[model samples]
Target: MTSPAPTLLRPDGSNLRVLVVDDEQMLTDLLSMALRMEGWDVKTAGSGFEALQTAREFAPDAMVLDIMMPDLDGMAVLQRLRQSGDDVPVLFLTAKDAVTDRVAGLTAGGDDYVTKPFSLEEVVARLRGLMRRAGTAHAAGAEPILRVADLSLNEDSHEVERAGTEIELTATEFELLRYLMRNQRRVVSKAQILDRVWNYDFGGRSSVVELYISYLRKKIDAGHEPLIHTVRGVGYMIKAPQ
Candidate 1:
């Protein structure tokens, strides 16, 4: 028999909105109970379709998705949401414990993953970490001219350039790229980004980080060689052009 899952306390004082998606009603209930104990406003869905619908209605701050759901897998749902430009942070739950599975989930746009038979405490901890990162990324200050490598970001002008060519960025996109550049080569976790940039802690979401990274890829790396390297199981890093 499995031991009782540990309880969790919500870190930010207010009730956070969270969506828990799993086909197993028992497991979903357990997860929801754990989150509620932390003072989160929790919602559960038993299928991919329901998860999406609930996500739209609930507008949750973060989501916990089971990767092996029936009808629609977590990766598929995540891809669809990302394609639609939803930036809600997602934590995947999977029965598979293989490294490949974890990599696949991250590559498919998941912020993090928890293996099945996991302690509820572990799940909550991961979610909190993801949310914290999301908060930091948005809370970063407005500093002019963030330089990393040959790349330069003029926050005052919202101009990005490498080797002297001009690059344009949206407001949010600019901040995201600037944060990465400011850290420059450091293995800055998504949580740190959220905390520094977004200002909230343990309540925001990480999907926004991925989406903005995608934006940066299009503007900064689509035509040029890749400069952003994803450190597997760590975070993201912006390095000098080599």
Candidate 2:
């Protein structure tokens, strides 16, 4: 019997680069191996300072960073990068699985988080989700623009605007809004959103989906007619104001 084919997350065949930052050399090597199997250019850093240097030099498309690194924890590294105006999508790896820890990471501009002792498959799935949301993995010229009334999303440019006013959105928010706008007028179930936007069904919390929807509403629906609507006991839908 033949071994299963390696998963290709990036449909566009672009040369995607990923940086894996962890103090554990073994973990970095393992992650590098798994990521390379997907045909990504994978780089590893064993320290926060080294990770910063690599991020600046390598300019990875996405990053998997450990939160407990010595000298400069992942949050500090991310803070420094953000201070320097780098908005690269980041996924935090932490041994702490508490809600506070997850929320802190997210609040600190992480695109996603994975707990320690995670399956390689789950990590890959999360990375895929981040890449997809960051608009780094999809083919260009395919549905370049999605619109619902005054709300518009330019997939190629990763831009969102409402009523001609530019709206800044994080990668995850862009992906969530894109999904909603693509399904305009239809109430998408929370499960479907989790599967499509997050690339996971198991252990997928609906609360996260709700939080993102609220974020979208603030940006896209605030001071407007409210394009995104919640259907009681169902999910969400984007519809034009009647």
Candidate 3:
């Protein structure tokens, strides 16, 4: 049999949080999408200052940093982070291909570096290596599964099951379920669901949250003792029926 896929997660058994810092919005969006597809929590910053601020608040396990920016380049950002004793693993993305630039980045505490016009697959693979090497993240074996009562979710394969039967989910639905499953038994607000499941540019509209929750309920809760619960004036949670 083919070996099962692997999942990279924080040592605490949670999704790995990653920071993607770049002056280019397009680049940041691309990287953010690639990382999130790996089931990682990703935050993007358009400048070094924003990156530092997000780092403080997000405490990401790894950072994909750009070396060139009009405001506070990656080297300066890394210096500042090191000064603050952040020690977060950084992967430098730059157009600079000079040997000296690579050495300088590594000397400045970057854990890895990739040239511009790079492959997303390669970037993801490199980040996997960097995060694992930094000891802040690790692969959760051949088959990484999340279980709650009779429902099971596979982070690696994007497969979900309920009571031993396979269930299908759209990309958005899968992410919603993953977020709910990740924080099983804990209420998560619609705002949280909107931010985490969809792209961050949802404009604070949460009606989609209710629509998707209904979609999930029809699939995940129909004909079974409800596992997903709603808290009036609050949000939603998934738990085992006692």
User: TM-score winner among the candidates?
Assistant: 2
Q: What's the CA error at residue 96 for candidate 3, in Å?
A: 0.8
> Candidate 2's residue-wise lDDT over 1-242, tens digit each?
97643344344556688999999999999999998887789999988999999999998889999999878999999999999998889999989988888889989998888998999978887887787777777643466788889888887678888889999998779989988988999999999999888765436568999899999888888899989999999999999989
Full-model lDDT for every candidate: 0.75, 0.86, 0.85
Estimate the TM-score for candidate 2. 0.72
In candidate 1, where is summed lDDT lowest over 10 consecutive residues?
A: 134-143
Poorly placed runs, candidate 2 (over 4 Å): 1-13, 147-152, 159-173, 184-186, 194-230, 238-242
Best-performing candidate as measured by lDDT: 2
- Per-residue lDDT for 220 in model 2? 84
What lDDT score is found at residue 213 in candidate 1? 78
The number of clashing residue pairs in each candidate reads: 22, 0, 0
Ranking by TM-score: 2, 3, 1
Where in model 3 is the C-alpha error above 4 Å?
1-5, 141-242
Residue 49's lDDT in candidate 2: 95
Candidate 3 local lDDT, 80-130, one digit each (tens): 999999989888999998778888998888877788889998788778766
Question: Which of the predicted structures, 2 or 3, would earn the higher lDDT when compared with the native?
Answer: 2
The CA-based lDDT of model 1 is what? 0.75
